[model samples]
Target: MKNKSLTFRIFINTFLVGTLIYFVCAFMFFGNLYTYFEEQLFNELESESIFLEDYVLNGDLLKLQNLETKNRITLIHSNGSVYFDNTVSFEEMENHALRSEFLGAKDKGVSKVSRYSSTMTEKTLYFAKLLSNGDVLRISCNQHSVWVLVLGMSQILLLILVIAVIISGISASWISQKIVHPLNSINLDEPESSDVYEELKPFTKRIAEENFEKAQREEIRAQYTANVSHELKTPLTSISGFAEILMQGGTDPKITVDFSKSIYDEAQRMTTLVNDIIKLSKLDEKSIAMEKEALSLRSICREVMEVLSASAKTKNLSLNLEGDSGLINGVEPVIYEMIYNLVDNAIKYNKIDGSVNIKIQEIQNFAGDRNKVILSVSDTGIGIPYSERERIFERFYRIDKSRSRSLGGTGLGLSIVKHASKYHNASMLVTSEEGKGSTFTVVFEI
Candidate 1:
């Protein structure tokens, strides 16, 4: 799980940082080793020069020669002559008196290191401290011992840093895998309860919620379409029926007038049904959203009455808006249709002196999340049969088929109301008894 691509990058990065820091620190630290060797050589030269001070002051050549062979030393005189040269002759060298060791002996009063000879590749440490007889000591070696030891240790440390980089890279792979593996399976469509990393829990919950909402929306849309199509068939059938009758017309004036009136009525019914269908479809598809502009429900009721009052007067029925109006979030066209259908149905099926009372009020619903604007149209008319009240919203369903046909009903009015409420995300409830008339309530959510 941990050995993922992300780990590889982490390992490489760590290795690089570690290696660079080590190199800088090691170089500075190892420099002290070289300095230590230089100090050792200089101290040895000082000791030898002091030992020879007593011997050289007495002009003891034999004692100096014995000491020089043991210490790898050489002696140079004040005039630049090699009296006892164990490493190289002074005159054979390149201007030893002009070199650092010679200058230190004369001026700085301390030891100095200088190159002795190219063939030997030796480094010499010179101590110019005066002997009792005034001679100098020069000790020389190749520094081969210090170089070999330090280089071997450096190689070991380099090997360790390389190993560290490798180990860290392996660990990095593990951590990267832990993060990215879960994300890669994001679109797997697994259930929320399925095994998943803790980090991905919120995402899984959201996906499930979206899927649930999608399914619910599709179900609602299907029901609305089926209901709308069923209702339109009544008017469509009427139009088709009359058109066939006209095609077979015999020349009876009374029959001609009656058939012509029927055809004209069916055609208008089909037109109304189609227009309402289109309007509801747009609302359902979300192409039309409710406009929140403030408008008086009471005023709209009067306007609806003005448009419909003549038809009511034809049957001597009274239509009135009985309650104070309220503002609602809805497109004007939808509200018009909603109110129109309820009142139209009432009037179409009412008695000679039937009355429709339009009552508007604000009420809180079950969820208490929103305030609903309700429009109730109650009629005193020939009411729905108790057994058929539920079927009224179904398309083309009419309780009194003969009477409804005579009144030029399209059978699509109630269905339009049902779909319109659904499109608005509202609800509709119907109540009626055989002789007590009906009330259709339109509940609109804000």
Candidate 2:
């Protein structure tokens, strides 16, 4: 019971207050009734006195002499000696001096009230008046009627208060539910705003804000996971391929020499993959501080193509730059790595004699506040499937696992391209489809 809810407590308090209020009303009502009963007793005593006086004035003494038996009337002599007993002899009982009405009536013939007096066996009220003949007429009546009336009224009041409290408790609980129900149903993780109570507006707004912040954090985490997997898979692929090559040692003498030479190629590929992945990881973690330098964007692209030209020739793909661009503020190696990855992926995945097209153009972005450098790499090869266009950049994700492994392609290439672009405040985008070819685009802030 002590563990009950706040609303339950409120209801209980309301009910108790209602019960108290009901009892207070009952007490006041009974108090008024008791006063009325006192008044009626006084009136009855006065009326009886008047009747007795009239009978005496008309000189009829014996007419209601036996009335003392029914009304508890006692006639006393002038000498303070009782002349009639009715129930007992005067000598057998104590003097009624403690009664106020007895003294008042004895001294002044006045009708008066009494102190509560009791017999050896019964409790009773005592009333008295003095006679003109120097005698005292006293009366005592049972208090049974008053006590019964009070007790019966109290019982009824108790019953009514109990019922009222139960009803009030139920109503209070219902009111509590009306306020708490809506709060229990709200979802704090989704991205939506809905109307709630005005008093609860602050809480609702806080929930919405937290949900939005949480969504942003989750998005960042997902991007990191995608970026990291691709980053790691690239180096692992080169290392594994080269290790496999070195294991088939000393075959045909020509084959043995060729395999040994090829090991160097694989090792360098692994080295490039590792360094790029680390750089991207640092950038993704925002732990790398880039020192921007002035360099021509066109010259950077051409230099990167020259380094990758031999790989393109081996794959029988044509790699060329189509436009010239002025100097851009960026770190040279970082820019070289970004362009190289994009150009390399294009050639590596191209069909025999496929062409890798590099284009650089200045364009206006939606913000309309600055010139943008758009670097696009388009290739003619096995194009991306429409469904896999967006997923191609995730780490370790390969459309054709066996073919990618055979080609010694590290799945992290495009992922590094993505992170490198982001590190340089660039926007990377892709357009592709199955059996046609693919184009990768980067928008660099200029």
Candidate 3:
């Protein structure tokens, strides 16, 4: 039952409600009908009793005896002795002294009473009137009890029930289909644009959100695959060409050595690219099991500068670290990778003899409480354009592809930085001019 379709449930609910209402109305109609019939019978009996009282008063016994009617007429003396009866001989009938209608008519001049038979399925209504001769005239009739009346009309009532069931079934089915049609017609790919019931707008909106996210993920996955293939192919082609040249016997020793070195460099480049891809995959998938701990941004900066110092020296770039040892709670290795990537990008893009400045500091809120730590890396380099700043953190996205490749940059550095910062509930801000320089700031809540 719980697994039934929506239409089925709707139909069942509608049918049950309709059936309930029908039963309630049927019982009420029967109740009022029974009351009306009983009242009509009583009124007829009272009128007949009034009309026949004159005949008994004028001593018209022959006329009363010859009269024909379905009702029973009885004449009782003032002392409750039966004088005459239409349906039976007065001597054969029981005494009426103890009867409620007899006593009531004797005192009130006229009275009415209903009595049920021993079987309880039949009843008799009596209207009695007191006469001028101190005798009583009674008119009586038989009636079926309420349950008997219902039983007598069982076939008609059953027919009505059948008709009701048929109508209710048709109405319920039609209504359920009308209600479910809009949901069935929803286009999952563009749910938000589909015409749907107002009550279901929130439901369709959720589907739209999921669809959008799925499309984005698929797009990113496709681009990442294509980029990885192209990036890997370049190094493989270089290594293959260099190895081929080195294999030829006529090559000079110095040139052969240079070719071998070129092959090794290409291999190293491919290795670096593979490792970066792996790191990004781990970060994206949340596959890393490392726990977060208290760490200093200043300490991490010092380590990144030490690792990249040689590369900075080659470009004649000065590496400087300033400000306090900003503390934060974060995964240590992920934090290290994020800082390393930012500093590396700075040094790689800086002009010859340019300076890469690393700063770590605490920021205070309006209440003067130091609740945030900021790490900003700025460099004197060919900075990013406003239009391209947003996409800089995309996987393998490079503004200057040739310069980026020449610098042995894998192009996933900023992407990794973005993911890692997000993992630590941090936000990254990029401020750059096309040619002057760029500043990358990561803000972390402590």
For model 3, how does the per-residue alpha-carbon lDDT over 222-334 read when each residue is reduced to its tens digit? 98899999999999998999888777778998998898889989999999999998888888877656698989889889988999999999999999999989889999989
TM-score of each: 0.51, 0.47, 0.82
lDDT tens digits, residues 1-446, model 2? 77567666766677777777877887788778866766666667667867876665565656646565455666565555565555666577655554566667777776555444343232355566777766677765654444566665777766786787877777767776765666565666541455466777787778788877888889977876775666556655856675676676645777656765676666766676667567667667775677889877788888989998998898788887877584567878878877887887788789888899999887665677677778898999888887887677776567898788567776777777777787778888889866678898888777
Candidate ranking under lDDT, highest first, comes to 3, 2, 1
lDDT of 1 at 326: 67
Q: After superposition, how far is residue 221 of candidate 3 from its true place, in Å?
A: 1.7
User: What ranking emerges by TM-score with the best candidate at the front?
Assistant: 3, 1, 2
After aligning candidate 3 to the native by TM-score, how far in Å is the CA of 78 from where it should be?
Answer: 10
Model 2 regions more than 4 Å off: 1-273, 364-369
2 versus 3: better lDDT goes to: 3
Candidate 3 worst ten-residue window by lDDT: 361-370
How much lDDT does candidate 3 score?
A: 0.91
Model 1 error, position 200 (Å): 3.9
**Model 2 Cα RMSD, Å?**
13.2
